[model samples]
Target: MVDVVACGELLIDFTPVQQKEKPGSIAFEQNPGGAPANVLAALSRFGKRTSFIGAVGNDVFGRFLQQTLIRLNIGTKGLVLTEEAHTTLAFVHLDETGDRSFHFYRNPGADIMLREQDVNEALIAQAAIFHFGTLSLTHEPARSATWRAVEYAKQHQRLLSFDPNIRASLWEDLEEAKALALKGMAKADIVKLSEEELAFLVGSEDVVEATAWMLGQYDLQAVFVTLGEKGCFYRTRNNFGTVGGFQVTAIDTTGAGDAFVGALLYQLLEVGESMLDIPQATLEDMVRFANAAGALTTTRSGAIPAMPTLSEVKSFMEAAR
Candidate 1:
């Protein structure tokens, strides 16, 4: 059985190589990316049986994306290649702090053209976890596809993993984005959010209270709030703690959060179905390992291309201590 199955966008990210210092000119390199795709790529590096359910175009760029995922051993049986629209492309701009801003070129890209009928229930039901983000909810057909898959996962009792991975520029309406994000949260058993996303949901910057409110408002088993350079905070029904971040001079922050989430899920899979029963100490150790994975990712560039392997993450963790 597949350990995890994710349904969302699979697109290319053109990341700039030169920063503010090189003001004369800027250069970009095409990288395989997408929030859900990045997570699956990170898991695949750790030898997890992961599958992705999404769409790309039938064009050359889409072919490159398909081959990249296949090379990483991510199942693409649920991937739809359509001629209805060209593949989506995102241009990434990284600031001096390594934080990123995005500009997307998707006037109804092939990813958003994913129809409800394109989602395969049999393929999704084989996985223990169903992962998704609100990016798929910005447009139709894909929105319907996402909802159908969520319902199928619920019926099959798969662990629902939600990451808002919110990029507000993609949403036409801020209120609608909030409402749709909350809708996804309601269906999630496990949530991983960036600090900004947490504040968006709770309307407060206080993470402790926001996490507490989320755990109470929804029947969530666990909540993880990623704090970038500060590492991350995780809370379960019975336990909560802050795991300090690894020290690294980050060059690019893209896919770092996805790497962290993927590492956490990798540890969860190793523990089998009894996830909530994991010891608090063991949970903290897992968070540290994940933080290492994320920090290592930032030292490099791109999304899927920069994801560190299990051995690399372990070595980073060991050397950090």
Candidate 2:
């Protein structure tokens, strides 16, 4: 039985690394990445039974990605290797603040080639939570596949978790992106958004006002807005509060948000589908642990490679206190 099943892109991230011998030159370090995959990696580290539903090319990079998930103990039975398109590759550029920008080589990537026929309904039916992002919705076939899986999960009474994970560069039109993002939110029982994403979706800089707008417009059980170093704000149907973040010297903020969402979902598993009934204090504590997980992730370099184990997160949280 899977605790969480994620459906979306799986690809390689080429993170920039400065060359020691050649001061002016930069080298790329290959790491397995993709928002949904990173989230599953975090959950696998927490001892959850997680599965991935996506596609990769039948190439070396694809093979590496497949092995990486297998090594992490994240189920790959739903993963597809196709020759329709090459595996997607992203080059990550980090600013001084460790915030990242992406340059993708996915004009016809294998991830977008995932067809509705590729979706595994059995996998979606067995999972307690079905998590997805808008990346797959940026293109065809995969978009239909994602919707099929989402509707199936909904019909099966599974908790739906949505993270917009917006990449402005990936979308051809900003309005279309916003529309599809809102469509995904309407189906989600829980949502995780970055501060910028909140502003982009709602057109408001005020977190309180924007979140209130979300709760009013959507039939959501809970919503989370991550504030980077400052921490996160959470709003459930019954209660709402803020959770302070852990202070860490971040080297790469690549998968911090994914790790945070993964950790939060891990805690949500204990409550089953009763997310709306969680006490404010308990929800705050969960967010605190998730913040620690995210902070620990940024202290390192890669996404999946940087995910902290359950013991590591617990120890870090204890030390912080």
- Predicted model with the maximum TM-score: 2
* Segments of candidate 1 deviating more than 4 angstroms: 19-23
State the C-alpha lDDT per candidate: 0.92, 0.95
Tens-digit lDDT track of model 1 for 28-133? 9999999999999999999999999999999998999999989999999999999999999999999997888999999988889888999988878899999999
lDDT of 2 at 277: 72
lDDT of 2 by residue, 51-136 (tens): 99999999999999999999999999899999999999999999998889999999989999999999999999999999999999
Model 1, residue 21: distance off in Å is: 14
TM values, all candidates = 0.97, 0.99
Looking at model 1, report the run of 10 residues with the lowest lDDT sum: 267-276
- lDDT leader: 2
lDDT of 2: 0.95
